[model samples]
Target: MSKKILISVVGPTAIGKTKLAIELANHFNAEIISADSRQFFKEMQIGTAAPNSQELASAPHHFIHHKSIHENYSVGDFEKEAIALLSHLFAKNDYVVMVGGSGLYSDVITKGLDKFPNVSPDIRKNLNEILKKEGIGPLQRQLKVLDEKSSNSIDLANPHRLIRALEVSIGSGKPYSSFLNKDKEKRPFKTITIGLQADRSIIYDRINKRVEIMIDKGMVEEAKKLYPHRILNALQTVGYKELFRYLDGEWDLEFAISEIKKNTRRFAKRQLTWYRKNQDIIWFDFNMSKADVFQKIDKEIITVQNE
Candidate 1:
């Protein structure tokens, strides 16, 4: 029996990962499993840069818009469901492609989820109270003090992520980052990770353009509809959060759009910071031609298969 391969296309947001993944899936005669946590929610289509109808029809895709914003979906849940789906996929195809910008979720599939000490519910309760009384600012400052590394890498804008890190840091009497990348679960398939990257200026420019396209595609209207559910964890995203502020009358639409661009740039930087730590990823310029990229990935696949 031959071993299966999981080719992961990963990089910063708006870096053409979805296009590359579709092409690879078609070349390899495989299906795609989305590791982008934000894309899993059905309500966040326009803002999350989810594959459109044409793109979804281009290849067999899994895990995109499979959950609702109202549902509680964790990385652990994703790991279980994705692995099961992979087993079913591998039975029919020798290769499968996984793509996303969510580093933590992707890591769960490739390198097992990290184990953390049990945190007391009271600690999270206290943190939520603080967030309610003040805002995410104080909690952000506290995490910066407790786990500066995590502060730089994780999405600092997400309150659920912030609270999770704080509770673990406080409960375990150690930095939250101290618990990461400590566990490895051997998988049944060989893995190849391809990363797309570009100059910081180019990446930021792409993000700015993407945000504009989203706004033009009625992201504000989508946010307005979901604004009533603003407190949901799924709603705690870059694009929607900014528009939520606009809807709250805290900022005008222009200012909100600018903040969305600025925050998205920061999110892209953090994503690169996270993926850079993984030495196994093969990096490529985002503008590389499809044929050239395909050649390099094919060579890698052959090398891994022979090993």
Candidate 2:
């Protein structure tokens, strides 16, 4: 049997990942499965910068705006669905493209997730209540006391992540990080990881430009429509969260826009930090032309297949 290949285009937000992935998919005549966690919500198109209708029409893409903001979709859910979709796609095409900036989601599909012990619902509910009443600071402190490793690694500001670690630590009497990388499920295919990056200033500039374009393209309107659901986990992401403050009386529109740009740059830095740990990835300048990138990928695929 021929070896199946999965090409993953990974990078910071607004680094032209979607365009590269589409071009690669078209070149390889393969389907695309998006790994962007924010782009999963159907109601968050403009804010999420999901593929427009023309881009969607250019290639067959899956998991783009496939779920609603009201739906609770987890990383585990994406891993299962994406792997299953890859299985089906592999039966027809030898190559498929996976693209996004969500490192956790990509890691799940490529390396498999660690098995975690189930914590009681009571613990989770209580944590949620504490978050609502007190706030994330309490939970962050609790996680630091219980599982300092996870507290340092996870987004401490994200209540959902902090509470998740706390619940597992308090309920199972074990640190959540202890479960990671214990047992990785082996997949049949080989993944070619291509990382796109630019200088810090260039990346920040791109992010700022993208934010301005998003605003002009009606991101505010989209956020307004979803403001009622701002409390949902799906809406807690970078772009929407900053805009939600504007919708609320918490910040002025100008400040909110500036905040979005600043937060997005921070998010991109975190993404680079995560992706840089893997030494196997072949990095490319984000400004590279499509032909040059495609040629490099083709050469890499050939090299991998030859080995």
Candidate 3:
């Protein structure tokens, strides 16, 4: 084997990405590295939709359930760890597959993470605290002043991203864009991106139904256990964040359920927006038959091997 191929399967939530990725991994005789930010934590299985053991048993996987919810993990950390894992896996197997909806995490591996100067922990903590107390509006203001270009392009509703941009701005006294737009670093492998796409209505319906299934699978109780840590950045996810409102008495049960569906649909939109920017992707519609998708993927792998 040439050891130069890494196939990435990416798409919006509940678009059957997991099932497809596993099939590709099997077809290529490779393992999987997850790019999901939430699924990194061990205690977050139900809410994060982390793969069950049976699914994992179908293929050797990495970076799933690898950390505690209490531990802090960043895109930089993911880049370092995932790359190391890839290097090790590629040493044994010629190719590997990475799959998830987290665009930043995938970018960290493919486009290369930008290097930034260190900032004191105090600045990050204080910015996070103020963000919690004041909501997204305050951080939005700071990020606009600090990096208007990137700020305008990002999801304004995501306070964690907004505040992180602010922290980088204040800490380095430079626009976050300065660091973000740095040149991409080279990697050894040839990347073959396979994007899963579907009709807008179908994707939205899947997202809504997936949220309901998550709740029925004990996501509410899981959120309750992590409510004390809701202020943590990792807990800023869609499903758990909405349920936290119910736990805090801000919304009735039915209202919270509705919010989860609405917010998840919004998340799927954001995900599509994010992935659309990557033109390197070879998109396959979600309606394709499983065997057909795998055949396409396997042919791509063999094509890559020939190169």
Q: All models: lDDT?
A: 0.93, 0.89, 0.85
How many clashes in each candidate? 0, 0, 0
What TM-score, computed on C-alpha atoms, does each candidate reach? Answer: 0.95, 0.97, 0.94
Better of 1 and 2 by TM-score: 2
What is the C-alpha lDDT profile of model 3 across 26-137, one tens digit per residue? 8878899999988998878998888888999999988998998788788888998888888988898788999999888887898899888788889878977887688778
Ranking 1 against 3 by lDDT, winner: 1
- The alpha-carbon lDDT assigned to residue 196 of candidate 1 equals 97
Best model number under TM-score: 2
Question: How much does candidate 2 score in TM-score?
Answer: 0.97
Model 3 misplaced stretches (Cα beyond 4 Å): 1-3, 298-307
Compared with the true structure, the alpha-carbon lDDT of candidate 3 equals 0.85
Regions of model 2 farther than 4 Å from truth? none
Better of 1 and 3 by TM-score: 1
lDDT of 2 by residue, 1-307 (tens): 5689999999999999999999999999999999999899899899888999999999999999999988888888998899999999999999999999999888889999878898899999998888889977888888888998888788776667777788889999999988888878799899999999999999999999999999999999998988888888888788888888888889999999999999899988889988987888889998888888888888888887887
Against the hidden true structure, what lDDT does model 1 obtain?
0.93
Q: Assess the local accuracy of residue 200 in candidate 2 as a C-alpha lDDT between 0 and 100.
A: 94
Candidate ranking (lDDT, best to worst): 1, 2, 3
Lowest-sum lDDT 10-residue window in model 1: 149-158
